[model samples]
Target chain A: MDNKTLEQLKEKANIIRKDIINMLAEAKSGHPGGSLSAVEILTYLYFKEMNVDPTNPQWPDRDRFVLSKGHGAPVLYAVLAEKGYFSKEELMKLRKTGAMLQGHPDMKGTPGVEMSTGSLGQGLSASNGMALAGKLDNKNYRVYVLVGDGEMQEGQIWEAAMTAAHYKLDNLTAFVDNNGLQIDGTNEDVKNVEPIEDKWKAFGWHVITIDGHDFQQIENAVKEAKETKGKPTAIIAKTVKGKGVSFMENQVDWHGVAPNEEQKEKALKELEVRI
Target chain B: MANIATREAYGAALAELGEKYQDVVVLDADLSKSTKTSEFKKKFPNRFFNIGISEQDLMGTAAGLATCGKIPFASTFAMFATGRAFEQIRNSIAYPNLNVKIAASHAGITLGEDGASHQAIEDIALMRAVPNMTIVNPADALSTKKAVEAAILHKGPMYIRLGRLGVPEVYKEDMDFRIGKGILLEEGKDVTIIACGFMVHIALEASSMLKEEGISAEVIDMHTIKPLDEEIIINSARKTHAVVTAEEHNIIGGLGGAVAEVLCENYPVPMVRVGIKDVFGQSGKPLELVELYGISAKDVAAAAKKAIAKK
Candidate 1:
């Protein structure tokens, strides 16, 4: 809320970005572009917005979060490790056979993951289910999900959007990481997901657009989402593909390719100097 | 013994189960009336969710409910539940080993009139491929009721296939039902006739037909297809030395394929598979379609004889 808190979150985001590079560099294969793009969103949720206990990860009353764009698991794993959900040691062993952190977000293997998600567009529906259960049980805990901009091409997202609005799931807030680039190319080149904000509105969701890297805007949108009633909110977060890194920034080639040793060094150095 | 659709028994059993387990929730993809989850909806309106026609959302939402310590039974036509939402069930429910029961009705050619598009001849094979998924194809009304109760008692993902056509009751009310165990209805030394779903009744009829021929065919109702009753299958195959499997599904990967795999690996018996022969169904009366699809009792009887001859 204040300059000190915002500055602290920014520092935390820088550290998480470095961790993403390091984890991907070690694993030799992962989505670094999307993970870096979603650093601020994950940092803000774990550090400031959400009410979760790392010690009691399965606390029933705790707020739940789903990483809808599950290929961006590096960011989630980094954030969860930072929050002490598991050891920071597990971050390196990601995607390894018999490791706790899977290639995708596995709720059973990972302590902080709310739902197992890798296949796109299914997380919002799972979020709606959790929100519906919360309403049924009369629990005040909210549900949050982060979906990729490219992930919007999935029809299940709209189906879930209709469900959330039809059920009046005010407790559910979704963030669309509009990084504008996918694995193939730019979203425009691959499949235009433009009129994105209007699409969520047409689905009866309260839409809010924000600069994803800005902590203050991310905070305000989450706050407004909580106060809104009778409908769920969709925060369309405009972000750069690979926000903090130099060579990877807005590069389509970085989508699923892990950085080599030299590239990882460059990326980490850039993150260190950015703040 | 009353004739009732397995879906109807499912509806009644779900309503009863809802009263006993307050955490039991039902979700349907706009086919609640057909799926018989409407009965559960009528009993627990607040707990039931009609997820519109979105089968993908239906499965994902059910998986979400399961994470919250609720036993969510997601229902739809078997075609949609396993066919359309295969990935959702795999990644969301089965992958997590979630406590979501997929009670899919209108399975097989017996769904009738809706034709090939609606018939789920490959559902068993699809579900069988997924790890941590337990496939239960119950025969008749009483077994369907017991299957519902067992699904609630069992944790993790389960696919309970039900039928639209009313079938003659093969078991009494107090029949012993277990998730992975098969029931031996009649014992014979010549050949074993293994069947699931509505085919169990046909298998019994085939056994009687074999009796007239002095073949002495054994009848076994293999309700649970996955985590299959391998012991019963191996033991029976060893004694009979011949096996015939009948199912209202594709012979490639249904009860027939499962039985074949067991016998070939463990007991190595002469086996004949009586099923759809890898063809889709056409719109017709249920019994007419059953006969036309080559899954009739006479078909099973002939298959049993063929297996016996091979032995």
Candidate 2:
């Protein structure tokens, strides 16, 4: 990523956080906590990295992205709309009936979405396929997959992890949105995924721990992933749930329930000043 | 007229796909010989993966490879692919709508000596249950080739069902194949015979037999079961007044069930389903198993006769 482009992306990522919260607030039915946690990761991928042409969404050689933690779709929609994959106007239509932006990312409707992922553990495996395909086709494009910390508890994720590491998909990068909160509550309260990075490393991934909200850290980790050879990279991003908002930070209620009108105004105001 | 096995067509098709698309990879769970993906492995050793006899692992691994940008085609018996790796196919492939092709061979009673354990009588229903899975049961060797090619080009999780024994080549190499579409063979006004996979032959033969018996029968190869060719099936039902659906599968939750579900919802036509009667098969000859399960041409003709009488 160019320094100017990186700086621009850093600024855009801050705006995305505000957009995510506001969109959730508008929908009055979204997962702001998770969405806020994954903003920087999506911004770095769409704005700085990934070989994607917004015009040619199905470019076979383009790098692929799968938002495995589907509830956090605001971050992805924000990034895709901003990157010109779709009209930014469609961002407000999220979760509304007849909207291209469904509650979950539907590949048939959404441009630049490699696969339809809403279920917890399936996204990593799909990304693993894309990475393996890149190797088979001798393509330089990488596969990026984002997973929720709570979602890692699903057994299918581990199965995919084992397969990715076993196959030596060096072109694959998986980022865990480790915000410590799930719909039920905290990750420890729901399902303890302690030693998360160690677990990924044991599964043969090149593991990296980073602050998810930090643009520089996220960018550096992705850069390291591109450098890693013969092993899939896993970024265990330690993040605060609803990091940008003061009222919703580390709060479980905001996981799925979108902010009402009053809450939306406060969130947007707080996010605008902080970033 | 019949010569080589349909599984051999799969082998040839895989080799062709590997040649055309470098990204086409094959994953075999120690069933390369049975599933006949050995040809694909020979051409693309770098793209071939032998993941032991773990069906669950095969599905997940295939999903992973697809995620990485490879169009992974995992080969195994239909029973193992659908039965054993069901959850993986559902969660990893179908749920996410990944482009993983499952080349499931030895489906239905044609699997023969392997008995009920290996026969995949419920694969169609099992796969069709998934929201976005494309359930394809190609009729003949040529149709298998076309179906395989079509499944690859189409973007999504697809299950391509193939037979074990040698079947007739019903279509020419130039025949165009489309996913979610049915191929209409013999059109008649007496009774429509909607079939898939091995039963497509039976339906064709039944059409001929029904013609001889002064009962005109419409025959359709409903290859894509999940996307039930409603346009053709409904039209056939409306014109013929009744329908006979055939397949070498269980009476419940198979092609018969799929067709019945379609008819019940839309047309409500009188139908006779000719397939396995919700029972398992015993060790026997391929033909013997097909006949014993009542999925042969004669049974289909009898079903056509019955469906016509219902009118």
Candidate 3:
């Protein structure tokens, strides 16, 4: 992509980060760390990547995305709102009882959501279906699914990985937000997903490791994924949980904890400024 | 009418769905022939996905397709879909409320010769326990078509339980069927006969025999067992003062339990649950096994009278 387009996408991502902070702060609950960490990737997909129609959200043959780790919905919600899938004001409704913006993604209630994901490792399989369908129908659309490092502990993801590889689902690309933190604590403290990239490669995916926060690197990885054929691709993105904000960054406590007013202000400010 | 099994109806409806809705796709777990989706695979080869024998992967794949604006009908035996891949259905499909219609054929004792291993007697209970899942058991080929159509339009994770063997078509082709509503087949004042799937036809036959014996009976095809047409069943039970539930499932956790739980909680009516008496099924012909388990018309009529005696 051109430098101008890249800068604009980054700007859009900052706006999404702002929404994530505001929404989480409003709900007084949610996964802020992972939400913040995934903003860059989410923004890149919604703004600079995926072929989605905000107006016709259910348009068939459109490029699909699955947010496998659904707790980080603040990021996805922000992206969807900005993209006009729903009103931007719906951000305040996040996690409210009976609200369309549920704790996790509800495919029926929300627009532009591919699956109702909150349970981890399952989204990969769903994306595998989309990729397989695209191949079967000979549709040119690509499928992207974002997963959490911690979410990888679930056995279904590997099951999907194996199936996707076996079916040669080249139309699918999965991104692992190596945020290092989960609900209880750090991923390493709980379960070791250390050999994650190798594990995916062994499953027959074309593996690419990149600095997830870097827009250019993410763009390049996505482009390279499209060029590769025969098997699915896995982009192992090393990202900071609760990125952009100083206090929230790398802190496992911030995994699902919402930022208070003061913290939100600081986070919003941090995202507004460059880097 | 032509020995059309409900499983074949599921496949036929899916094949038809593929023709109309380009976004509709079918996923199978290597039992396409058993599930009767092989016909669909033949008609719409591109939309039919064979995910090998992995039931978990099959469910997860269907959920994924639903997210991408595709309506996915996942075909598998009820034993596998609801038993093996239940977590996948709960987590991926029901949890997300994705529009993944699980068309599980070979439900209940009608799976016959396959024994207890292949019989999905507890699927309704397991699938109903999961939040945001719409459970259905269509009695005949026509109702199966309607259930499949309704499930496709329902806009949530759904389970449509169908049988393997051919049963009498109990509904008219023009009969209306909503996803969660029950249809009252016959009206009586002595006992309310509530049944679903294969038992619905049995209930109607039982009610007719009871009528000839001067024992007035109310027959309701309790098709959609989840958001159960409780109002109709409860009203009938209150009016008739007794209820009898029959299914090709176990008495422990199937339509019998689902109905008993609802009735005992709200309306405490004398109810007899006619099905497998908490025992695993043995290999036999579909009809023979159903009759052997007392999930047949004669058994249903006897159970209806037993229930009435309590009242």
TM-score of 2: 0.82
| Winning model by DockQ | 1
Model 2 spans > 4 angstroms off: A1-10, A51-62, B1-4, B20-24, B49-74, B80-101, B112-118, B126-135, B149-158, B166-194, B200-243, B257-270, B279-292, B296-298, B301-305, B308-311
Candidate 2 lDDT, B1-311, residue by residue in tens: 75556778999999987888876889998889888899998887888988666677688668767755668899999999999889878876787677899989999888899788888888888987899888888888888888888988889899999888888767755776898889888879999988888888778888898889898888888888878788888888899989998888888998888888889999998899998898888889999877777888899998888877787
Question: Can you tell me which runs of candidate 1 are displaced by over 4 Å?
Answer: none
Please write out the lDDT profile of model 1 over residues A30-71, one tens digit for every residue: 999999999999999999989999999999999999999999
Cα deviation at B61, candidate 3, in Å, is: 2.4
Q: After superposition, how far is residue B99 of candidate 1 from its true place, in Å?
A: 0.8
TM-scores, all candidates, are 0.99, 0.82, 0.85
Provide the global lDDT of candidate 1 against the true structure: 0.94
Candidate 2 Cα deviation (angstroms), residue A182: 1.7
Output the number of the lDDT-best candidate. Answer: 1
Ranking by TM-score: 1, 3, 2
- Using lDDT as the yardstick, the better of models 2 and 3 is 3
Considering the two chains of model 1, state its CAPRI-style docking category. Answer: high
Docking class of 2: acceptable
Cα lDDT, model 1, residue A121: 92
DockQ-wise, the better of 1 and 3 is: 1
